[model samples]
Target: MVHQIRPRNSASASMASRKISSMLPSLMRQVIVAFIVGVLAACASRAPAPAPGAPAAQEPAPVRLGPLGGPLAVPGTLSQYRSHWVPVAWEELPGWQDDALHEAWEAWLRNCERPAPAFAPLCPEARRLSIASEEEQRAWMQERLRPYRIESADGNANGLLTSYFEPELQAARVRGDGYEVPLYAPPPGLPARQPWYTREQIETRPEVQAQLAARVIAWVRDPIEALVLHIQGTGRLRVQEADGSTRLVRVAFAGTNNQPYQSVGKWLLERGLVRDATWPGISAWAQANPDRVQEMLWANPRYVFFREEPLDALAADAGPRGAQGVPLTPGRSIAVDRSSIPYGTPVWLASDGPSAHLARLVMAQDTGSAIVGAVRADYFAGSGEAAGELAGRLKQNLRLWALWPRQ
Candidate 1:
C-alpha cells in the first residue's frame, strides 16, 4: 500500500536518511525469549504427509516416532537469534486519528498489556518508550533501521521514509478472548479515498492534511512494535480443479524464467487476468485444473525439496560424520526467518491437507530468495522420484507456531 508516487532525484540519499530513521525499539530485548519460543513451535510442526495423488490440505497426522526425535541439538542459544531491527514509517496506520482508528489501536494495545494473554506478553519495556534521550533514541534508531526505498523500473526514485518494525512483535485480537472489544466499522460517509490525496485536491483537503499530521504524530510518540515485511519467492504449484482438470502454474517475478502460467502481470498484459496477477493467476489456474494438478507438480523441478529433520538422526547416527551419507526422508520443507526463529527449530504447522496430524521435527536447513522477514516461512515437500508425485500440489493456508525450551 505505498501511497507516495512522486519520484526523487536522489536515490542513495533517500535510502540513507530512511535507514537512520527506522530504528529498533529497546522493548525488543524483553521479547527475545518469547519470540524464539514461538519460532521453534512453528518449525516443529511441518506439513503432514500427502496421501497418494491427493490434493494438499491442512491437517496434522498422528504423532509418530521418527529416527530423529526433534530439532537437532545446535550450538547457539536462542539469544543468538537477535539480529538487526528496522524502523517503519506509520504511513498507513488504518484509521489514523479518526475516532475509529484510535479505538482500534488502543484496544489492540490494551489486550497486549494483559498478563498471560494469548498474544505476546506485553512488558513495561514497551510502555517505557517515552523516557529515552534524543541521543539514545537516535543511536538505537541507527543500529536497527533498514531503509525501505522505492525504485521504479526506470530507476527513478520515490519518496522515502524511516519505517520498519521489530521482527518479533506479534499482536492480534481474536474471537472469544473475552475482552469483548467490538470491531470498528468505517465512519459513515467516509470518502472512497479517505487518506490518499489526489494531485488536484492535495491543497484543498483539510481532512487529508489532518490525517497525515496525525500519522506523523503517532509515529513520533508511539512505542515501537513488530515490523511487517514482504517475502517474495518463485515456485510452481500443481492446482487441481473440481472439474477434474490440473495445471502446472509457474510462480516468480514477471521476467523470471519460472513465471507462473497465469502470473498476474502476464495475465494483465495478455488481458486474461486483472491487475494483481500472481495471486489471481494462481487462483484462476487452480480453478481451471483439479485432478492432474498433483501430477503436474511432480513434474516440475522448481517446487520440490527436502526438509531437514530438526535433529538429523541419520547425520547424528553418522556420529560426527557431518552431513555424510545420511538417509534423507521425503517430506515437505519450508524456509523460515532464522533471526526470529532459528534454523532447524521444530515447528507445528496445521494445514488443510491429507498430511493432517502428521508431526515431525524440522531442520531450518535452507532459505529461498523470497523467504525473508519475521513471522515468514517457506515449506518444501520432498524431491526426486519419491517426491515427484507430491511436490507442487500444495496450496493451503497454514497456522504455524514453534516448540522449544520451556520458558
Candidate 2:
C-alpha cells in the first residue's frame, strides 16, 4: 500500500518544485534592483547639482605678515604693485589709526623741505595738508602713498632696531670752576683726508692742545660728559660764562677726526668691569675706579669736533639736524642706512618686545655710520636726559615698509 502512494504524483511534484526554485532567484534580483534605484534617487535629491558653468578658479592666497614662526601665507598681487617691493594695505600697519598723525605730519613737512625724487612731486600737497586731522592725514597718505614692505637683499623683512638721542650737559666758556675738558672745532692741521690726534693724543699732547686751543667751542667738567657729546655727535650745552651768566646753546657736529670709532662701554664689558655697560653703568664703574678713566677713553680712538650753533626757536624745539639737512622730529625720525632707505623716504615701522611696542610712520631723515645694513635703523628718541634713557634701552626686532609714491 505504501509503494503505491509514493509513486502517485512523485515526478510531477519534483518538476513543479524545480520550476519554483528557478523563479525565486529572479524575484530576489528584482527586489535588490528596486532598493538600489530608491537609494540612488534619495542621494540625488539630497545633493543639488552644481552650477552649469565651469567652476571658478581658486582665489589667491592672503598676504603674509610673518607670525612667530615665519610667513604664514603668500602675498598675492602685491609683487605686481612695485618692482623689488611688496605692497600692503593700511590694515597691515598695526596701530595705524590710533596714533597721533599730527606729530608725524610735522615730520613729513620737514621731509618736504628736501623730499626724495619720488616724493618731491607730492611735497606741495603735503604742505597743504599740514593742518589736517588724523583721519584726513591718513586719507591723504592712502591717496598719494604706496606702502612697500622693506625686504633685505636676501628677501628678509626682519631686522634690528636701535635708538639715539640728543644729550644735555653743563658747559663753560672758559676752562675754570672744574670745567677743564674741552670740546673743539675742526682744526686746520687735521686734513679732511688724514686721521687726526686720537682720544689719547688730544688729551695729553701739548702740541695737540696748541692746535685745538683757539678752536675750543665750550668746556665740560666730566670727561664722560665730553665723551657722551662725541658719541651723540651733537649736544645742548648749558654754558656758564665768565660774567656768571648762563645760556643754552647747541654744539653741532662739525666733523670727525677720521679715526675709527670704538665703544668704551664695549671695552669695559669685554673686560667684565661692569655688569651692564650702559652710560650710567660706565659712570658707576668710573666712580669706583677713577685711575682707569684715561684707559677707558683711549679705547675709543675717534674724536668728534663740534661748532657752536645758536639755537633759534625752531632749532631749540627740534632734534639734531640729520644727514638729510633737515631737523629731525623725535619719535618720527629714523637714521637708516642711506643705501637701504634713501634720505627723505617715508617708512612705516613695526616693532614689539618686552621693552616697547612701536608701530608708526617715520621719515628716513638721518643716517649713522653704525646703521649699515639693508634693514637697520637708529630711531631718534628725543632730546635731554629722559630721551637718553629711552634711547639707550631701545634695541628690538623690527619690520619696515617704505611708503613710496605710486608709479
Candidate 3:
C-alpha cells in the first residue's frame, strides 16, 4: 500500500517525487508469460471447444494483454465541485471507440449481479451490446448513462490512479521443500481492532508461533513472497500436498492485525539507501544488505492472515472475488473509496502526466484504505508479477468522471 497521501497544496509536486517502480520492461513481459503459462495449465484439463471457424489450436487470450503503449488522451473538461455534462460531448472521451467494450461487458454484468438501483435500468441494454458495433455501443451509452467530471471540494481535479494485482506463487501443504514460511488464519482470540503480533514477533516469538502451530494454509519459501501475498490481499497458491499431487487454490484476505501499514520502499528511501523506491530497487538493496532484511520486514507492523479457497476451472479463469462479491475484470475493475463514489458505479478515468497516461471505463467494485477522495481510484491492471510491478510504478495525475444512470 502507498503510504503518502496526497497533500492538498502540492498535488502535482507530490506525484513528481513519487518513484516509479524500476522493474525492467523485459522482466515484466517474462512475468506475464509465466502467469499465462500457469493460467493455461490450470485450464488445460477443462479446455473449451473452439468456436466454429476459429483457429483449432488457439486458446482464450488472457485479459489485459500488456503495458500502456504511451499517452492516451482526448478533449476533456474540468471544473470545481462538479463539471457540467452539458458542455462535454461524447467526442470528448478519448479512445472511447477504440476500447473493446465487450471486454468490459463482463464487469458490467458483474455490477448488475448486485445491481445498484440506478444501474438496474441499464442492465438489459448492456447485455445486448456484445454484438453491437463500437459506434452503436457508444451511442447506446450516451443515451443510457450520464458522465460528470469530479473534483475535490477544495478544487483539485488532478488525483492519483495506481493499480493492483493478484500474485501467483508456488507453495506446499507441508513444511518441507524449503517452504518454511507459513501463511496463517487469524489465530483464535485475536481481537478485531487490537494489533496482534507484529511481523518480527510472528518470526521470532515462540509463544506467538505456538498459537499458529498447525495453522499453515500453505508454505511458501521466500519471506518476500509471503509479504507480497499479504500486501495484495489475495493470490493463487500452487500447492503440492503430501500425497504427491498438486492443485491450485486461492489464499484470500481474512483479516489484518490492525497495526499501521508502512511501505518497504519508503523504509529504504528514508534511510538514504536508495534513489528510486521501487521493487527492483528494494531487491537490489536487499542483495547488498542481506542482514537488514529482518529490519526492513519489521518496518510495517501490520500482518495479514489468509484462508484457503478451492480453485476450479472457472475460478482459475477469472480473478479473485472483490469486496463487491463479483469476480474482478482485470483491466476494467478499480478499487475506490465508497464515500466518494459508491461501489457499482462505472467511471471514466483518464490520465496524462510525466509518469503515465490512460483512458478507460472502470467499475468501482472494490475499496482500499489508501483509496480516498472524490476523484481517486486504484486501477486493477491484471494478475501476477508484471501486474504488481505496474501497480507499484503507477503514480500519475488522474482525471475522473462518474458515469451515473441518466435520469
Candidate 4:
C-alpha cells in the first residue's frame, strides 16, 4: 500500500522557519537578497510578452506514488482455470501492515525448496533476507513483487474459508487390547485410478478383509478416530510396539479408494439423526448411539490409506508433507485450489470468524478435493487436538491476494 510521508505539520514548519530566520541576522545579507529579488522581477517584466492567442504555460502534473514511495506500477493480468488475477496496490490488502511477516519467513523458505518457476530466481535474496529486519523485508518485497487480488472468473471476490488439521492418536502396532480398528496402507493388487471397494465393502467382505489384514500399519482404539484420520489424510501415531517400546511415527497419505467421498455427518443430518455436524458433535452422537457407530461410518464410501514414516525429533516438530512436497509450517501453510493459486505461490489471507481472526502470509502448498474455487481455502491448523478443534469450527468468509514477481 502507498504510504506517503506527509510534509511536516504547519506548526513544526513555522517553528523551523522562525529558527532559520533568527540564524540569518546580517542587514547586508538582507540587502543583497532584496537586490537579487529586484533584478529577477525586472528581468521577468522586461521579457517579451506572449502574442495574442498564444497558449499559457501550465503546471507540471503531480507524481503518483506506489507502495513505500515508489513509482506506481502498471497493473498486470494472470489467468488460471477458475480464477483471474487483477493487479492491486499492496495497501489494498487487508491488514497488510499488521501481519508479522518474519513469522511467515520459514514457510517462504520451505516454498523455496520447491519453488514454482516464477519464484525460483527470488529464493537467494529471500534466504538472505531471512534474518533481515521486518522493515527491510517489506522494502524488498515492495521493490520486487506485485500484489494481485484473486477473484472468480465471473468477478466474485468473496469466498468460503474452512480448515483441516493433522490428527494425533494413540495406537498400537498390533490388533489387540481394544485397538481393533486398523489403519491400512494401500491394498496389494488394488487397481490404480479405478474404484476398488467402498468403506462398507472393505469392512464386511471377508475376501477384502483377508487381503487388507497384512497391510495394517497400526491399530487405534476408536473407530471414529480412524475415520477422522482417514478424512484428514495424514496423522501422527504414538504406537506401542510388540517389543514393549513406544515410538512416534507419521502416517502420510498414500492413496484413496476411487469411490466418491460422502460426509458422514451430512448423512446423519439428512437422516435427522444429529443436530450438529462438526466433528465433536459427530463424536457425541457416536457415543450416544454406540450400536450404530459402524452404520454411521459406512455412510462415507471413500477411504484413505496411509504409508508410515519415522518421525525423528526434527520431523516430529514439522507438519505433514503437503502437495508441494514440503513439510507445512503451522499457521503459514494452506491448501488451495491448485488451478486458482499454483503450488508454492505466496498469498495474503484474511478471514474473520468465530474460530479465528487471521490476516497473514500463507503459502499455497497443498490442495484438496473440497478446495476448488477461486477464493476458497482449507487452512492447515497444525497437529493434535487443539488444532483439530479449530479446524472443526472454522467456516467463514475469505479473501486472497497473490504476491507475484514484478518481472
User: TM-scores for all candidates?
Assistant: 0.25, 0.77, 0.77, 0.79
lDDT of 3 by residue, 1-407 (tens): 22112110000000001112221244653342222111110000111243478544322222211121100121111211122222143444555556777677788989988887667778888878867777787788877765655556555556767666777878898886566667888788878887777777776788988998877687876666666567667778988989989988987877776777676656777999877654446556766776666677677677777788888987676777776777888889988766666678888777764435567788988877767877688787667776765655566667776776644
Residue lDDT tens for model 2, 78-195: 2222113456665556666677888888899998887767788898888888888888988988877766666775677777777776768788999877666788888885678687
Task: State each model's CA lDDT, in order.
Answer: 0.26, 0.65, 0.63, 0.69
Maximum-lDDT candidate = 4
What is the per-residue lDDT of model 4 for residues 1-407, given as tens digits with 9 covering 90 to 100?
00000000000000001112222223322321121111110000011244578566333223333332222332322332446666776766777776899999999999999988888889999999999988888899877887877777677777877777776878899877766778889888778799888888887889988999899898876555565676677889999999999999998877777776665556777997766554345545655776666676676677777799999997777888888888898899998877778889899988876557888899999887667788888888888767766665566788888887875
Which candidate ranks first by TM-score, i.e. highest? 4
The model with the greater TM-score, 2 or 4, is 4
Instruction: Give the local distance difference test score of model 1.
Output: 0.26
In angstroms, how far off is 276's CA in candidate 3?
A: 4.2
Cα RMSD to the true fold for all candidates: 27.4, 34.0, 13.1, 24.0
Tens-place lDDT digits, model 1, residues 1-407: 00000000000000001221232333332231111111111122232243478665333322222122211232234333422212123121111112212212222233233322212332243234335554443343223322211112232221111101112112122222221111111223334423322211322357744543322100111111101111111112232323546443322211111211121123233644333333334334434553422322222111111111222333221111001111212232344545544443333334434322322323333343334444343443332222222221332334344433222
Q: List residue ranges in candidate 1 displaced over 4 A.
A: 1-76, 80-329, 353-358, 384-389, 405-407
